[model samples]
Target chain A: MSITAILINAFALVCLIYGFYRDRDKAVKSLKKAAKSLFGILPTILIIIIIIGLMLGFVPPAEISRFVGEQSGILGVLLVGAVGAVLHIPALIAFPLAASMLESGATVMAVAAFITTLTMIGIVTLPMEIKILGKKFALLRNGLSFIIAIIIAILIGVIL
Target chain B: MLLAGMFIVALILVSIYPDRRGAVFNTSMDYLTEMAFILPAVMVLMGLFSVYIPEETVVKHLGKASGSKGFFLAILFGTLPTGPLYVAFPMASTLIKKGARISNIVVFLSAWACIKIPQEMVELQFLGPEFMLARLSLTIIFVGLMGFVIEWMMKRTNGVIDG
Candidate 1:
């Protein structure tokens, strides 16, 4: 396993042991919750994996890069950002997908825009947000998030 | 529903293009392996946080603080590996009802949406430390500023936000 995997697993293990020592019932409950949530999200996970597989398989790196690579520029970043806002995939799964895109010749700006907008702006959840937080607050937050996501993407491209 | 559609689509595509099947399978396997190694651990950490850090605790802490301290607490509470952003919506509503500052509520909600601790670890695993750290810091700075801006705009409009 990679060091990242090892470190994350070790951290979870230590937390588990500590929790068990502190309260056996709560620890076991957490384990059950973990398993339940894992299963709950499993189908979406599989779907994402399949999508990634197809994307990497069918699309040549050159073609992939041409749209989202260095030459793609600001337009590419905006396009991916808009897609990210519309799609409702879990953020946990988005990282690996972003990594795959990066590996296949996507620019840092595009990937950053995609991930930032994916997590920060939720066009899918706008109705619910409006229902709970009012339209103005929801609109402002989402609208501002899209703008910042673009800015963040550009800044990441510059700095990294 | 989407899962079923994906599977059917994948099957047909692979069968039609036998030459690309190996590439597709290999890519999927690689990602599946990576996910297998980290997802369970990430889920466990999330479960533990959800179980231990009650929503009540978050509200209690976030509702009381003010000024810079409130902003710090908001980010701290928001970054905990708890439930999804939807879960935070109601909590934020509750905080607002309790008279928490609008800027702090915005900060808390934005942080909950992004910059999550477990989420960051996953990003680091896939995107490397340089990419993840840069995004994280940039996100924090901008989200912080956005919070104040939103609050200011709402204040200027005067009672425009009535959820």
Candidate 2:
């Protein structure tokens, strides 16, 4: 692990330990809750990540690269950004994936738009986010994020 | 044992509900396969995050005083952070407890989820520098704007959670 990673882990450990030491009962309750939730969902989440990785490994980055490589100005930027908004991909995966697309000849503007939307717009996670943060907040945040992402994409398209 | 129970439930549901059960089963199977690939790395990260960083530390650096510039810094800091989105939600809750602004938390989580630069660098090795830089710049701007928008919306709606 990197030094950063080690530091982070140490930090988390201290917090958790502090919490437990400060209030044993509360700590126990919280830990139990965490375990239940983790046990129930960790496997599911883990399985999903692996499946995504496999699909990514198998799919030809060239295909995605070609589609996103079109630099038709504003229209291309919007199209690419919109596509990113609709599809949810992990950010870690998205970067490498975006990079591969770029290597395969994808346009910078399209890739930027795609990454912006991928992180900002939570189309797939919309239901979950709305459930947790409420409809109004979720809608406002996501809509604003998408608009901002588009603007940024345009700026990058022009500036870089 | 859990697997057996799941299989039994699947059998019963399929017999009674047919299409619904079949679709659910298929989806679960697909999800399981996907998790298998990403789990180990995610697990290691989780273990590290839990064992390493003190919440107080993340809160100290990421607290709202971190401002617009702080907001940008938090987003970048968050991007490299390795954890599930849900993990951040509770951490955000805690940060709120520690006097962090809701807007900042939202920006951190949003950027953490979206604009990871280091990860982007790895992709850069494969995708090309121009594309990664473009994506990173756009994402940073979006995340910063998101913080302001969220702040505005929360104020108007009176949605700020009392920490």
Candidate 3:
């Protein structure tokens, strides 16, 4: 596997070992929770993988990028960013989708904007935020997040 | 529902373009394997963090700090791998009720939303070091800035709460 993957596995292993040493019950409980969550998210993961395949295997880069490609510019970035904000995909799954789009011609800016906004702003959970944190705090956090999401995207596009 | 739609699309593509079926299958398998490598590990890490570091611990520790130290505490506590952002909203409310600064709460919630370690590991795996690291560092700076701006805006609109 990639070195990053290796490091992740290694880190997990170390954490697991240490966790068990600290408390065997909690460590096993964690593994159980891990298994449960994995099964729960599995279908979504499969669906996302399939989507990524279709995106990269069939669509040519030029065609894919037309809307989100480098030349698609600020409008493209904003479009994907809005989708990110509205959609409620798990961020783990979102990464592969974002990476697939990047491979298939989406601009760095657009992809960054999508992931950033997707994780940062949650339309589905906005009401909960509003209920708990009040309308003003919820609105400001989400609103400013959108603006910075674009700014971060543009900065990423320029740097990388 | 989306999964069912994806499966139907995949079936149709395989049937209509038999030649491309192998390509699609192979690509999906490739990504599936990659995800298989990290998802469980990430989940395990998350579970461990959640179990080891309970919300009570966060409230107890973060409730004590204010000013610059509180901002760093918020970011640090937020970066500890936990559940989803929705799980954080109530935790944030508790922080506020406990008298944490609005700027710190904003920073805490933003970091909780975007900058956890497992999330970073996934981003690093998929998006490369440069992309992951750049977005991360930029996120830290911008989220911190957003926190202060939001705090300023809130004070302007609602006046200052003495709590």
Candidate 4:
């Protein structure tokens, strides 16, 4: 596990321990809730895993860079943003890839759009989001997020 | 049924492009491992929040009267070193159920997704201070506005919107 993952688990453990010490029944209740939720979402989680695997595995690297390359302009930024919205790579991995794109002459706007949309929108997780948070909230948040991600990228381009 | 269909399609794809099987499997395993580590802990945290923190308290903090304080609080809570965006969905649902303002919840979510501290550090390391700072500031402004805009649209649409 990554250090961040370890730390997160440790934090959860600490919280559980503290809760148990204060109120065993409530702590157990939380554990039950946790287990229930984990099981409930397992299928969606599996789907997310498979989808992410396909996206990252199948897309050619050259194609990826080309879609968001410097010469691509606003259309390139839009394409990069769309890919970022669909591709579910962790931000931890996304930064280095984005940086490399920058190094290889991807425009500032395209890179920015890629990172922003990658973090903000999740087409793969849309069903789970809709299931949990309702269709309106999910669709609106993601739809608006996509628009604003591009706007942020453009503004970044203008500024720097 | 969808899952089964997806599985079959994947099977066919792998059979057709045997050369890509390793990449697909390895990537799937990598993500599965990552999710295994994080999801349970995230669920536990959510459960703890649900059980320990009273609904009224949550409502008070981020509910209808959450006000501008809720906005900043959402940003603060969101920027904490939580996991990814998918993990935030359940928590956001719980908050909404507890009567948290939709706008604040949106801000919290966007912040959780984009401005997590470690991600920012990585951005700084890779993309330079200028790019990082500019994007950060711009993201904050635009994400906040997006939240309000979405919230307004939801309210304006009224019961027509199932949000």
**Which clashing pairs does model 3 show?**
A65-A69
iRMSD, model 3, in Å = 2.2
Task: After superposing candidate 3 on the true structure, give the runs of residues whose Cα lies further than 4 Å from its correct spot.
Answer: B1-5, B160-163
Kept native contacts, fraction for each prediction: 0.82, 0.20, 0.73, 0.74
Question: Which lDDT tens digits does candidate 2 get at residues B1-163?
Answer: 5545555655665667554554455544544543334333333344333434456667778775656776755775576455446456656666766677667777877766665443443344434556556666656666666777777777886756532
Interface RMSD, all models, one decimal each? 1.1, 9.5, 2.2, 7.5
At residue A86, candidate 2 shows an lDDT of: 88
Better of 3 and 4 by lDDT: 3
Model 3's TM-score against the true structure = 0.96
DockQ of each: 0.81, 0.14, 0.68, 0.44
Show model 2 residue runs off by greater than 4 Å: A1-67, A103-105, B1-50, B54-56, B59-73, B97-99, B159-163
lDDT of 3 by residue, A1-160 (tens): 9999999999999999999999999999989988888898899999889988887778878997899987888999999999999999888888899988888889999999999999999999998888888888898899999999999999999999
Best by lDDT: 1
- Pairs in clash, predicted candidate 1: none
The 0-to-1 C-alpha lDDT of every candidate, in the order given, reads 0.90, 0.60, 0.89, 0.79
lDDT of 1 by residue, A1-160 (tens): 9998899899999999999999999999999999999999899889989989999999999998888998889999999999999988889889989999998999999999999999888888899999999889999999999999999999999998
- Candidate 4 RMSD to the correct structure: 7.0
Worst lDDT window (10 residues) for model 4 chain A? A96-105
Better of 2 and 3 by TM-score: 3
Write model 3 residue lDDT over B27-57, tens digit each, in one string: 8998999898899899999889888888999
